[model samples]
Target: MIRVVAVLALLRLAAITVAALPVQWVALRLGSSLADRLPVWWHRRALATLGVRVTPRGTPSSERPLLITANHASWLDISVIGSLGPVSFVAKSEVATWPVFGLLAKLQRCVFVDRTRRSATGRTAGELGDRLAAGDPMVLFPEGTSSPGDGVLPFRSALLGAARAAILDSGHTRVVVQPMAVVYTRIGGMPIGRADRHRVAWYGDMDLIGHLWGVCIAGGLDVEVVWGEPQIFEATTDRKALAATLETSVRDQLRAVLRP
Candidate 1:
Protein backbone atom coordinates (compact mmCIF):
# COMPACT_ATOMS: atom_id res chain seq x y z
CA MET A 1 0.00 0.00 0.00
CA ILE A 2 2.85 2.35 0.83
CA ARG A 3 4.52 1.50 -2.45
CA VAL A 4 1.32 2.29 -4.29
CA VAL A 5 1.03 5.64 -2.58
CA ALA A 6 4.65 6.48 -3.30
CA VAL A 7 4.21 5.62 -6.94
CA LEU A 8 1.10 7.77 -7.19
CA ALA A 9 2.85 10.68 -5.49
CA LEU A 10 5.87 10.37 -7.77
CA LEU A 11 3.63 10.44 -10.82
CA ARG A 12 1.94 13.61 -9.59
CA LEU A 13 5.32 15.23 -8.95
CA ALA A 14 6.54 14.29 -12.40
CA ALA A 15 3.41 15.70 -13.95
CA ILE A 16 3.80 18.98 -12.07
CA THR A 17 7.42 19.29 -13.13
CA VAL A 18 6.64 18.55 -16.74
CA ALA A 19 3.78 21.01 -16.79
CA ALA A 20 5.87 23.83 -15.31
CA LEU A 21 9.11 23.25 -17.19
CA PRO A 22 8.14 24.87 -20.49
CA VAL A 23 6.32 27.82 -18.92
CA GLN A 24 9.26 28.54 -16.61
CA TRP A 25 11.67 28.25 -19.48
CA VAL A 26 9.72 30.75 -21.52
CA ALA A 27 9.40 33.08 -18.58
CA LEU A 28 13.13 33.03 -18.06
CA ARG A 29 13.79 33.68 -21.73
CA LEU A 30 11.41 36.62 -21.74
CA GLY A 31 12.66 38.02 -18.41
CA SER A 32 9.19 37.99 -16.91
CA SER A 33 8.39 38.38 -13.20
CA LEU A 34 6.68 35.02 -13.49
CA ALA A 35 10.16 33.55 -13.55
CA ASP A 36 10.54 34.68 -9.96
CA ARG A 37 7.08 33.52 -8.89
CA LEU A 38 6.29 30.23 -10.59
CA PRO A 39 8.80 28.34 -8.48
CA VAL A 40 7.02 29.39 -5.28
CA TRP A 41 3.75 28.05 -6.59
CA TRP A 42 5.38 24.91 -7.89
CA HIS A 43 7.16 24.21 -4.63
CA ARG A 44 4.03 24.75 -2.59
CA ARG A 45 2.08 22.38 -4.76
CA ALA A 46 4.90 19.83 -4.60
CA LEU A 47 5.00 20.05 -0.80
CA ALA A 48 1.23 19.66 -0.64
CA THR A 49 1.27 16.68 -2.96
CA LEU A 50 3.92 14.98 -0.80
CA GLY A 51 2.07 15.71 2.47
CA VAL A 52 4.89 17.95 3.79
CA ARG A 53 3.72 20.80 5.96
CA VAL A 54 5.95 23.84 6.45
CA THR A 55 5.71 26.07 9.48
CA PRO A 56 7.59 29.31 8.92
CA ARG A 57 8.55 31.40 11.93
CA GLY A 58 9.80 34.96 11.98
CA THR A 59 9.90 36.96 8.76
CA PRO A 60 12.24 37.17 5.85
CA SER A 61 14.01 40.49 5.65
CA SER A 62 12.68 43.11 3.23
CA GLU A 63 16.01 44.81 2.76
CA ARG A 64 17.56 44.92 -0.67
CA PRO A 65 20.86 43.22 -1.45
CA LEU A 66 20.01 40.51 1.06
CA LEU A 67 21.82 37.21 1.54
CA ILE A 68 20.16 34.52 3.64
CA THR A 69 22.41 31.98 5.32
CA ALA A 70 20.80 28.68 6.22
CA ASN A 71 21.75 25.25 7.50
CA HIS A 72 21.39 22.35 5.01
CA ALA A 73 19.69 19.12 5.98
CA SER A 74 17.94 17.58 3.00
CA TRP A 75 16.92 18.12 -0.61
CA LEU A 76 13.48 19.17 0.61
CA ASP A 77 15.03 22.33 2.08
CA ILE A 78 14.73 23.92 -1.38
CA SER A 79 10.99 23.35 -1.63
CA VAL A 80 10.38 24.32 2.00
CA ILE A 81 12.17 27.64 1.62
CA GLY A 82 11.14 28.27 -1.97
CA SER A 83 7.50 28.04 -0.96
CA LEU A 84 7.98 31.06 1.28
CA GLY A 85 8.94 33.50 -1.46
CA PRO A 86 10.94 34.24 -4.56
CA VAL A 87 14.63 33.59 -3.93
CA SER A 88 17.52 31.96 -5.71
CA PHE A 89 20.10 29.58 -4.24
CA VAL A 90 23.86 29.34 -4.17
CA ALA A 91 24.60 25.68 -4.80
CA LYS A 92 27.60 23.52 -5.62
CA SER A 93 28.49 23.35 -9.32
CA GLU A 94 27.83 19.63 -9.35
CA VAL A 95 24.14 20.36 -8.84
CA ALA A 96 24.08 22.03 -12.24
CA THR A 97 24.97 18.68 -13.76
CA TRP A 98 22.37 16.67 -11.91
CA PRO A 99 19.70 15.07 -14.00
CA VAL A 100 16.32 16.90 -14.05
CA PHE A 101 17.10 18.76 -10.80
CA GLY A 102 19.87 20.66 -12.52
CA LEU A 103 17.47 21.97 -15.12
CA LEU A 104 15.05 22.96 -12.41
CA ALA A 105 17.78 24.76 -10.48
CA LYS A 106 18.78 26.71 -13.56
CA LEU A 107 15.20 27.76 -14.11
CA GLN A 108 15.16 29.06 -10.55
CA ARG A 109 18.26 31.15 -11.34
CA CYS A 110 20.59 29.42 -8.87
CA VAL A 111 24.21 30.53 -8.81
CA PHE A 112 26.44 27.53 -9.21
CA VAL A 113 29.70 27.63 -7.27
CA ASP A 114 32.56 25.30 -8.10
CA ARG A 115 33.84 24.63 -4.60
CA THR A 116 36.61 22.26 -5.61
CA ARG A 117 38.50 24.93 -7.51
CA ARG A 118 39.77 27.77 -5.36
CA SER A 119 40.18 29.90 -8.48
CA ALA A 120 36.48 29.68 -9.27
CA THR A 121 35.46 31.03 -5.88
CA GLY A 122 36.20 34.63 -6.72
CA ARG A 123 34.21 34.47 -9.94
CA THR A 124 31.29 32.84 -8.21
CA ALA A 125 31.43 35.41 -5.43
CA GLY A 126 31.36 38.20 -7.96
CA GLU A 127 28.34 36.66 -9.67
CA LEU A 128 26.52 36.26 -6.37
CA GLY A 129 27.39 39.84 -5.50
CA ASP A 130 25.97 41.02 -8.80
CA ARG A 131 22.72 39.18 -8.17
CA LEU A 132 22.39 40.56 -4.64
CA ALA A 133 23.18 44.05 -5.90
CA ALA A 134 20.25 43.71 -8.26
CA GLY A 135 18.00 43.27 -5.21
CA ASP A 136 17.74 39.54 -5.63
CA PRO A 137 17.54 37.53 -2.42
CA MET A 138 20.07 34.72 -2.48
CA VAL A 139 20.02 31.73 -0.13
CA LEU A 140 23.40 30.35 0.85
CA PHE A 141 23.83 27.04 2.62
CA PRO A 142 27.11 27.82 4.32
CA GLU A 143 27.41 24.35 5.76
CA GLY A 144 28.56 23.39 2.22
CA THR A 145 27.06 19.92 2.69
CA SER A 146 23.81 18.50 4.02
CA SER A 147 23.72 17.04 7.50
CA PRO A 148 21.57 14.30 9.03
CA GLY A 149 18.98 16.86 10.24
CA ASP A 150 20.30 16.54 13.81
CA GLY A 151 23.18 19.05 13.75
CA VAL A 152 24.67 21.85 11.70
CA LEU A 153 28.11 21.58 10.20
CA PRO A 154 30.55 24.45 10.56
CA PHE A 155 29.84 27.20 8.03
CA ARG A 156 32.49 28.16 5.51
CA SER A 157 33.32 31.86 5.34
CA ALA A 158 34.56 31.97 1.77
CA LEU A 159 31.20 32.63 0.04
CA LEU A 160 30.36 35.21 2.66
CA GLY A 161 32.73 37.31 0.57
CA ALA A 162 29.70 38.02 -1.64
CA ALA A 163 28.32 40.29 1.05
CA ARG A 164 31.35 42.51 0.78
CA ALA A 165 31.19 42.30 -2.95
CA ALA A 166 27.54 43.35 -2.94
CA ILE A 167 28.36 46.35 -0.78
CA LEU A 168 31.01 47.43 -3.26
CA ASP A 169 29.05 46.70 -6.42
CA SER A 170 25.81 48.34 -5.40
CA GLY A 171 27.47 51.23 -3.55
CA HIS A 172 25.20 50.27 -0.65
CA THR A 173 26.24 51.08 2.88
CA ARG A 174 25.67 47.52 3.97
CA VAL A 175 24.22 44.15 3.00
CA VAL A 176 21.82 42.27 5.21
CA VAL A 177 22.84 38.69 6.06
CA GLN A 178 19.87 36.92 7.58
CA PRO A 179 20.28 33.60 9.36
CA MET A 180 17.64 30.94 8.61
CA ALA A 181 17.14 27.36 9.80
CA VAL A 182 15.22 24.39 8.32
CA VAL A 183 14.42 21.62 10.77
CA TYR A 184 12.49 18.42 10.17
CA THR A 185 10.59 17.88 13.40
CA ARG A 186 7.89 15.32 12.75
CA ILE A 187 6.68 12.54 10.46
CA GLY A 188 3.19 11.08 10.36
CA GLY A 189 2.14 13.71 12.92
CA MET A 190 4.53 12.34 15.55
CA PRO A 191 7.89 13.61 16.75
CA ILE A 192 10.78 12.16 14.80
CA GLY A 193 13.59 10.46 16.69
CA ARG A 194 17.22 10.20 15.59
CA ALA A 195 16.61 6.84 13.99
CA ASP A 196 13.75 8.22 11.88
CA ARG A 197 15.81 11.19 10.62
CA HIS A 198 17.31 9.19 7.77
CA ARG A 199 13.85 8.86 6.29
CA VAL A 200 13.74 12.63 5.87
CA ALA A 201 17.32 13.86 5.67
CA TRP A 202 19.34 13.13 2.58
CA TYR A 203 23.04 13.11 3.28
CA GLY A 204 26.28 11.24 2.76
CA ASP A 205 26.15 8.60 0.03
CA MET A 206 22.41 8.01 0.16
CA ASP A 207 20.87 7.33 -3.22
CA LEU A 208 18.60 10.15 -4.28
CA ILE A 209 15.97 7.94 -5.89
CA GLY A 210 15.71 5.67 -2.90
CA HIS A 211 15.61 8.50 -0.37
CA LEU A 212 12.98 10.36 -2.39
CA TRP A 213 10.88 7.23 -2.65
CA GLY A 214 11.16 6.72 1.10
CA VAL A 215 9.99 10.25 1.75
CA CYS A 216 7.06 9.79 -0.59
CA ILE A 217 6.11 6.52 1.05
CA ALA A 218 6.42 7.89 4.58
CA GLY A 219 4.75 11.26 3.81
CA GLY A 220 3.31 13.46 6.58
CA LEU A 221 6.53 15.42 7.14
CA ASP A 222 6.52 18.56 9.26
CA VAL A 223 9.30 21.14 8.80
CA GLU A 224 9.97 24.29 10.74
CA VAL A 225 11.72 27.27 9.15
CA VAL A 226 13.05 29.89 11.52
CA TRP A 227 14.36 33.23 10.36
CA GLY A 228 16.82 34.92 12.70
CA GLU A 229 17.55 38.60 13.06
CA PRO A 230 19.26 40.17 10.09
CA GLN A 231 22.88 41.17 10.58
CA ILE A 232 24.28 44.13 8.68
CA PHE A 233 27.43 43.37 6.73
CA GLU A 234 29.48 46.47 6.21
CA ALA A 235 32.84 46.99 4.57
CA THR A 236 34.52 46.40 7.88
CA THR A 237 32.52 43.33 8.96
CA ASP A 238 34.67 40.25 9.54
CA ARG A 239 33.51 37.48 7.20
CA LYS A 240 34.62 34.66 9.44
CA ALA A 241 33.03 36.22 12.52
CA LEU A 242 29.80 36.85 10.64
CA ALA A 243 29.73 33.27 9.40
CA ALA A 244 30.28 31.98 12.93
CA THR A 245 27.48 34.18 14.29
CA LEU A 246 25.03 33.00 11.64
CA GLU A 247 26.02 29.40 12.26
CA THR A 248 25.36 29.80 15.96
CA SER A 249 21.96 31.39 15.26
CA VAL A 250 20.92 28.53 13.01
CA ARG A 251 22.21 25.87 15.41
CA ASP A 252 20.38 27.47 18.30
CA GLN A 253 17.13 27.61 16.34
CA LEU A 254 17.47 23.99 15.28
CA ARG A 255 17.99 22.92 18.89
CA ALA A 256 14.98 24.91 20.03
CA VAL A 257 12.72 23.30 17.47
CA LEU A 258 14.13 19.78 17.67
CA ARG A 259 14.47 19.49 21.46
CA PRO A 260 11.71 21.68 22.78
Candidate 2:
Protein backbone atom coordinates (compact mmCIF):
# COMPACT_ATOMS: atom_id res chain seq x y z
CA MET A 1 0.00 0.00 0.00
CA ILE A 2 2.87 2.38 0.80
CA ARG A 3 4.54 1.64 -2.52
CA VAL A 4 1.27 2.14 -4.38
CA VAL A 5 0.72 5.44 -2.60
CA ALA A 6 4.25 6.62 -3.36
CA VAL A 7 3.96 5.74 -7.06
CA LEU A 8 0.62 7.53 -7.32
CA ALA A 9 2.04 10.56 -5.57
CA LEU A 10 4.98 10.69 -7.97
CA LEU A 11 2.69 10.29 -10.96
CA ARG A 12 0.53 13.18 -9.73
CA LEU A 13 3.63 15.32 -9.29
CA ALA A 14 4.74 14.52 -12.81
CA ALA A 15 1.31 15.32 -14.21
CA ILE A 16 1.16 18.63 -12.38
CA THR A 17 4.65 19.58 -13.54
CA VAL A 18 3.92 18.74 -17.17
CA ALA A 19 0.48 20.38 -17.34
CA ALA A 20 0.75 23.32 -14.96
CA LEU A 21 3.27 25.45 -16.89
CA PRO A 22 1.40 25.34 -20.20
CA VAL A 23 -1.95 25.90 -18.55
CA GLN A 24 -0.63 28.86 -16.60
CA TRP A 25 0.97 30.40 -19.66
CA VAL A 26 -2.21 30.04 -21.64
CA ALA A 27 -4.26 31.46 -18.80
CA LEU A 28 -2.00 34.48 -18.55
CA ARG A 29 -1.69 35.15 -22.29
CA LEU A 30 -5.31 34.45 -23.08
CA GLY A 31 -7.68 34.41 -20.11
CA SER A 32 -8.64 32.45 -16.98
CA SER A 33 -10.95 29.98 -18.70
CA LEU A 34 -8.20 27.45 -19.36
CA ALA A 35 -6.64 27.95 -15.96
CA ASP A 36 -9.98 27.52 -14.25
CA ARG A 37 -11.08 24.46 -16.16
CA LEU A 38 -7.77 22.61 -16.17
CA PRO A 39 -7.36 22.55 -12.40
CA VAL A 40 -10.77 20.95 -12.00
CA TRP A 41 -9.63 18.27 -14.38
CA TRP A 42 -6.45 17.76 -12.43
CA HIS A 43 -8.18 17.79 -9.06
CA ARG A 44 -10.74 15.22 -10.17
CA ARG A 45 -7.94 12.94 -11.28
CA ALA A 46 -6.06 13.50 -8.04
CA LEU A 47 -9.15 12.72 -5.95
CA ALA A 48 -9.69 9.44 -7.78
CA THR A 49 -6.03 8.51 -7.72
CA LEU A 50 -5.85 9.26 -4.02
CA GLY A 51 -8.85 6.94 -3.49
CA VAL A 52 -11.08 9.64 -2.07
CA ARG A 53 -14.79 9.46 -2.80
CA VAL A 54 -16.49 12.83 -2.58
CA THR A 55 -20.25 13.19 -2.50
CA PRO A 56 -21.41 16.81 -2.71
CA ARG A 57 -24.82 18.09 -1.75
CA GLY A 58 -26.33 21.19 -3.40
CA THR A 59 -24.47 23.19 -6.00
CA PRO A 60 -22.39 26.30 -5.59
CA SER A 61 -24.29 29.49 -6.39
CA SER A 62 -23.92 30.79 -9.95
CA GLU A 63 -24.61 34.33 -8.76
CA ARG A 64 -21.83 36.80 -9.18
CA PRO A 65 -19.70 38.01 -6.29
CA LEU A 66 -19.92 34.63 -4.60
CA LEU A 67 -17.97 33.94 -1.40
CA ILE A 68 -18.05 30.46 0.05
CA THR A 69 -17.35 30.18 3.79
CA ALA A 70 -16.48 26.69 4.90
CA ASN A 71 -15.12 24.78 7.87
CA HIS A 72 -11.47 23.72 7.67
CA ALA A 73 -10.55 20.12 8.49
CA SER A 74 -7.49 19.23 6.46
CA TRP A 75 -5.69 20.11 3.25
CA LEU A 76 -7.87 17.54 1.50
CA ASP A 77 -10.71 20.05 1.77
CA ILE A 78 -9.06 22.00 -1.04
CA SER A 79 -9.09 19.17 -3.55
CA VAL A 80 -12.60 18.05 -2.59
CA ILE A 81 -13.99 21.53 -3.13
CA GLY A 82 -11.80 22.36 -6.13
CA SER A 83 -13.17 19.29 -7.87
CA LEU A 84 -16.51 21.08 -7.91
CA GLY A 85 -15.72 23.96 -10.29
CA PRO A 86 -13.48 26.78 -11.52
CA VAL A 87 -13.40 28.45 -8.11
CA SER A 88 -10.35 29.96 -6.41
CA PHE A 89 -9.51 30.28 -2.70
CA VAL A 90 -8.76 32.93 -0.09
CA ALA A 91 -5.78 31.41 1.69
CA LYS A 92 -3.29 32.54 4.31
CA SER A 93 -0.38 34.53 2.88
CA GLU A 94 2.04 31.87 4.11
CA VAL A 95 0.63 29.39 1.61
CA ALA A 96 2.21 31.49 -1.10
CA THR A 97 5.61 30.31 0.07
CA TRP A 98 4.84 26.60 0.06
CA PRO A 99 6.70 24.84 -2.73
CA VAL A 100 4.41 23.05 -5.17
CA PHE A 101 1.19 23.86 -3.35
CA GLY A 102 2.04 27.55 -3.44
CA LEU A 103 2.55 27.46 -7.18
CA LEU A 104 -0.74 25.69 -7.64
CA ALA A 105 -2.54 28.27 -5.50
CA LYS A 106 -1.03 31.09 -7.54
CA LEU A 107 -2.07 29.42 -10.78
CA GLN A 108 -5.57 29.10 -9.39
CA ARG A 109 -5.38 32.84 -8.64
CA CYS A 110 -5.98 32.49 -4.89
CA VAL A 111 -6.30 35.64 -2.80
CA PHE A 112 -3.73 35.40 0.03
CA VAL A 113 -4.36 37.31 3.24
CA ASP A 114 -1.76 38.16 5.89
CA ARG A 115 -3.72 37.44 9.03
CA THR A 116 -1.06 38.73 11.41
CA ARG A 117 -1.03 42.25 10.01
CA ARG A 118 -3.79 44.31 11.57
CA SER A 119 -3.40 47.03 8.95
CA ALA A 120 -3.55 44.52 6.11
CA THR A 121 -7.17 43.56 6.73
CA GLY A 122 -8.58 46.42 4.72
CA ARG A 123 -6.15 45.81 1.90
CA THR A 124 -6.83 42.08 1.88
CA ALA A 125 -10.56 42.67 1.97
CA GLY A 126 -10.24 45.00 -0.95
CA GLU A 127 -8.38 42.36 -2.92
CA LEU A 128 -11.00 39.76 -2.10
CA GLY A 129 -13.70 42.25 -3.04
CA ASP A 130 -12.05 42.75 -6.40
CA ARG A 131 -11.98 39.02 -7.05
CA LEU A 132 -15.62 38.65 -6.03
CA ALA A 133 -16.70 41.56 -8.22
CA ALA A 134 -14.90 40.03 -11.14
CA GLY A 135 -17.16 36.97 -10.97
CA ASP A 136 -14.50 34.64 -9.61
CA PRO A 137 -16.03 32.59 -6.82
CA MET A 138 -13.73 32.63 -3.80
CA VAL A 139 -13.71 30.22 -0.87
CA LEU A 140 -12.72 31.16 2.69
CA PHE A 141 -12.19 28.90 5.65
CA PRO A 142 -13.48 31.21 8.36
CA GLU A 143 -12.40 29.21 11.38
CA GLY A 144 -8.90 30.70 10.80
CA THR A 145 -7.40 27.26 11.36
CA SER A 146 -8.04 23.62 10.68
CA SER A 147 -10.13 21.64 13.17
CA PRO A 148 -10.14 17.99 14.27
CA GLY A 149 -13.25 17.21 12.15
CA ASP A 150 -15.16 16.29 15.30
CA GLY A 151 -16.73 19.73 15.47
CA VAL A 152 -16.51 23.30 14.13
CA LEU A 153 -14.76 26.18 15.72
CA PRO A 154 -16.35 29.60 15.95
CA PHE A 155 -15.92 31.47 12.67
CA ARG A 156 -13.70 34.50 12.95
CA SER A 157 -15.93 37.25 11.60
CA ALA A 158 -13.14 39.65 10.73
CA LEU A 159 -12.60 38.19 7.29
CA LEU A 160 -16.31 38.16 6.63
CA GLY A 161 -15.82 41.92 6.35
CA ALA A 162 -14.67 41.22 2.81
CA ALA A 163 -18.29 40.74 1.80
CA ARG A 164 -18.98 44.30 2.77
CA ALA A 165 -15.91 45.42 0.86
CA ALA A 166 -17.18 43.54 -2.15
CA ILE A 167 -20.56 45.22 -1.89
CA LEU A 168 -19.08 48.70 -1.60
CA ASP A 169 -16.13 48.25 -3.96
CA SER A 170 -18.18 46.70 -6.71
CA GLY A 171 -21.26 48.83 -5.99
CA HIS A 172 -23.20 45.60 -6.10
CA THR A 173 -26.26 45.70 -3.89
CA ARG A 174 -25.96 42.05 -2.98
CA VAL A 175 -23.35 39.30 -2.83
CA VAL A 176 -23.91 35.60 -2.26
CA VAL A 177 -22.41 34.08 0.91
CA GLN A 178 -22.57 30.32 0.80
CA PRO A 179 -21.95 28.11 3.80
CA MET A 180 -20.18 24.85 3.01
CA ALA A 181 -19.31 21.79 5.08
CA VAL A 182 -16.74 19.05 4.47
CA VAL A 183 -17.04 15.94 6.62
CA TYR A 184 -15.10 12.72 6.58
CA THR A 185 -17.87 10.21 7.30
CA ARG A 186 -16.39 6.86 6.43
CA ILE A 187 -13.21 4.89 5.96
CA GLY A 188 -12.84 1.49 4.39
CA GLY A 189 -16.62 1.26 3.77
CA MET A 190 -17.53 1.60 7.45
CA PRO A 191 -18.65 4.53 9.54
CA ILE A 192 -15.57 6.03 11.13
CA GLY A 193 -15.51 6.57 14.88
CA ARG A 194 -14.08 9.78 16.28
CA ALA A 195 -10.69 8.29 17.02
CA ASP A 196 -10.46 6.78 13.54
CA ARG A 197 -11.64 9.98 11.88
CA HIS A 198 -8.66 11.83 13.30
CA ARG A 199 -6.54 9.93 10.85
CA VAL A 200 -8.12 12.00 8.08
CA ALA A 201 -7.63 15.29 9.87
CA TRP A 202 -4.45 17.37 9.68
CA TYR A 203 -4.26 19.87 12.44
CA GLY A 204 -2.28 21.00 15.51
CA ASP A 205 1.41 20.43 14.71
CA MET A 206 1.07 17.58 12.25
CA ASP A 207 3.88 17.25 9.73
CA LEU A 208 2.59 17.74 6.20
CA ILE A 209 4.69 15.03 4.54
CA GLY A 210 3.77 12.41 7.12
CA HIS A 211 0.08 13.30 6.89
CA LEU A 212 0.19 13.19 3.12
CA TRP A 213 1.79 9.75 3.23
CA GLY A 214 -0.84 8.51 5.69
CA VAL A 215 -3.65 9.85 3.53
CA CYS A 216 -2.22 8.19 0.44
CA ILE A 217 -2.08 4.80 2.10
CA ALA A 218 -5.51 5.16 3.69
CA GLY A 219 -7.75 4.01 0.90
CA GLY A 220 -11.58 3.90 0.85
CA LEU A 221 -11.96 7.30 2.44
CA ASP A 222 -15.34 8.97 1.94
CA VAL A 223 -16.04 12.68 2.28
CA GLU A 224 -19.36 14.47 2.08
CA VAL A 225 -19.60 18.11 1.06
CA VAL A 226 -22.75 20.03 1.88
CA TRP A 227 -23.53 23.48 0.53
CA GLY A 228 -25.97 25.37 2.68
CA GLU A 229 -28.52 27.72 1.26
CA PRO A 230 -26.84 30.83 -0.10
CA GLN A 231 -27.43 33.96 1.93
CA ILE A 232 -27.44 37.56 0.79
CA PHE A 233 -24.74 39.99 1.88
CA GLU A 234 -25.69 43.59 1.46
CA ALA A 235 -23.92 46.85 2.14
CA THR A 236 -25.80 47.17 5.42
CA THR A 237 -25.18 43.63 6.54
CA ASP A 238 -23.41 43.05 9.86
CA ARG A 239 -20.38 40.93 9.20
CA LYS A 240 -20.25 39.19 12.55
CA ALA A 241 -23.95 38.45 12.51
CA LEU A 242 -23.57 37.00 9.05
CA ALA A 243 -20.68 34.88 10.26
CA ALA A 244 -22.85 33.51 13.03
CA THR A 245 -25.50 32.54 10.54
CA LEU A 246 -23.02 30.70 8.36
CA GLU A 247 -21.55 28.99 11.39
CA THR A 248 -24.93 27.59 12.32
CA SER A 249 -25.60 26.27 8.85
CA VAL A 250 -22.20 24.63 8.54
CA ARG A 251 -22.55 23.01 11.94
CA ASP A 252 -25.92 21.59 10.99
CA GLN A 253 -24.54 20.13 7.81
CA LEU A 254 -21.56 18.66 9.58
CA ARG A 255 -23.79 17.10 12.17
CA ALA A 256 -25.93 15.59 9.46
CA VAL A 257 -22.92 13.96 7.83
CA LEU A 258 -21.56 12.61 11.08
CA ARG A 259 -24.87 11.29 12.36
CA PRO A 260 -25.38 7.56 12.60
Candidate that scores best on lDDT: 1
Q: Which 10-residue span in candidate 1 carries the lowest summed lDDT? A: 161-170
- Tens digits of per-residue lDDT, candidate 1, 168-247, equal 87678788999999999999888999999999999999999898888888858999999999999988889999999999
Clashing pairs in 2: none
Cand. 2 Cα-lDDT: 0.85
Candidate 2 versus the native: TM-score?
0.94
In candidate 1, clashing pairs total 0
What's model 1's TM-score?
A: 0.98
Number of the top TM-score candidate: 1
Error of 2 at 27 (Å): 1.9
- lDDT per residue for candidate 2 within 75-157, as digits (tens), equals 88899999988889988898899878888888788888898898888888888888888888899999999989979999998
Query: What are the lDDT figures for the candidates, one per model?
Result: 0.92, 0.85
| Residue pairs with backbone overlap in model 1 | none
